[model samples]
Target: MVEPVDPLQRLPFGARGPLLDHLSRLRHDLGKYVSLQVRWLGASPPPEALRQAMMADLLETHRGPGGGIDAPTVWAGLRPALVGEVPLDDTITVDLSGDVDFERLDDAMARISGVVRDLRGGVDGPQTVATGIEAARTVSDACRALWSRLRGG
Candidate 1:
């Protein structure tokens, strides 16, 4: 049962840059819309605009001094010697002590997951056929620019 070892895997995580940022490589399915012929329906249509927010951008924008994606994920695989029977707000308390905002923390995490899900599968935004075609080109150009600390025009 011998197998070859991946040289990339042997390197520390930091040594691997965007090589492991699979997030970017995920599938992006672009949805499309078009006008219908002889559609004189008088009902007000639902708002065509979609609220597209980049969750990671908000996380990294450091108007404050220190910034990082602090979540329970970092405390994962924690093996405490004991599990308490105590309950905090109906949640089973663990032997390990941490933040009291467990409820809100979970919600925050779900939001990040949702944004990632949408980005991977959902279309970026609404566009006509011609615009959608143009979007494919513009998107490729934008993605190539890596975010940096420098602020400029």
Candidate 2:
């Protein structure tokens, strides 16, 4: 059996404009929140009052060149604050080649499997509940195994 060809691929050059537009809008909206979060994280170390004051200034005032906070101040805090923005904007893809250490993922998978097993075992009082628990446990096992293999075991 032949799979149907994707019609979208047959459209005029890169005709995914609408889809791209929608995604762009979504990214922009998400960027606003990310920007706010970045600002918040930068100010996190300061006392609350100082943070609030800086936040008000940053939000409300437009600074002339060399006018507001000194260059060193913004350079120090802003760099760390914007740490995850490139990934957030979909501009920079994290090269997970060596970064994805699966040790923690393995631990999490073990915990989840143990919890599922425990829950299935705990549902022994009712026959219908026991059946449901078994079904759920089977599904969880399949998914957990698949995920473990996908994440390089």
Candidate 3:
């Protein structure tokens, strides 16, 4: 028997705007965190309070309503990247180590930026929806790549 398809896999092409918007917002938030982390590289260890605050802010952003995007979906998209090849807890965490690979982080940010740029190109209707779905997938893949590099996988 053919396996049943997931409904989410069939999200209508016209309904992609919210998902795209969520990703765009996520990209913006992550960009800020990455930038801050990069700036602190090779400097004294980042303050524990600052790290905690940043994590809280990032979590808030992820949990906030993204027009229609939900937290579980976002986590699902990011899980592969977050966990890498090794199985690990699904909690969202980041490396605050000064030895982080900034280059890879920048690359991931660039990919996200590209998606946002593409989606904002004035396309409308079904075309925009299609673009949004593609953009989301691209960002997810970028995250996976970034995580792999970060973990030295």
Candidate 4:
């Protein structure tokens, strides 16, 4: 078994609490983001194929075989590290095992953040859409610790 790295060791010190706290919150809020995303996809009644594709991607990306380091996985990792209890069965199962690359997840998260920011910036969108995007951003922000710790930034 690959030994888990001590996330705190990566930090410079003094920032551990805030960083860990952020990751913990991110893990908590990720659920809200998923719920909002699902609701937004359904609200417009978009084409069945498109919706299915999106959800399929989400499932594969977040819970499928290879830990893609999406919000959920990142969130899951933090709890066990912090509480000293490894999660044997996630709320959603992951089929592959390995260290997650934070960079890719970081980029994907940035894109999502941008979209959410636009909604909040008054980009002339429907209230529902704006609300959903805002919710997603709010949830994503909760993971700042997860990102920082993972990225060793």
Q: Where is model 4 more than 4 Å wrong at Cα?
A: 1-8, 34-101, 113-153
| Displacement of the residue 59 alpha carbon in candidate 4, Å | 20
State TM-scores per candidate.
0.23, 0.21, 0.27, 0.30
Model 3 spans with C-alpha error above 4 angstroms: 1-61, 65-124
Which residue segments of model 2 deviate by more than 4 Å?
1-15, 40-44, 47-153
Top candidate by lDDT: 4
Candidate 3 on 46-96: residue-level lDDT in tens? Answer: 555434332332233253455433222443453333223322233322221
Q: How many pairs collide in each candidate, listed in order?
A: 0, 0, 0, 1
lDDT of 2 by residue, 17-52 (tens): 433343233223222221232244453354444333
Off by more than 4 A, model 1:
1-100, 125-153
Tell how far residue 37 is off in model 3, in angstroms.
30
- What local lDDT does model 4 show for residue 80? 51
The candidate that achieves the highest TM-score relative to the unseen native structure:
4
Worst 10 residues of 4 by lDDT: 90-99
Tens digits of per-residue lDDT, candidate 1, 1-153, equal 966543323433342333223112211111001011101222433323212112222222122355433112221211121123343223323322232222222333344334334444654443322232233223223222211100110
Error of 3 at 140 (Å): 0.4
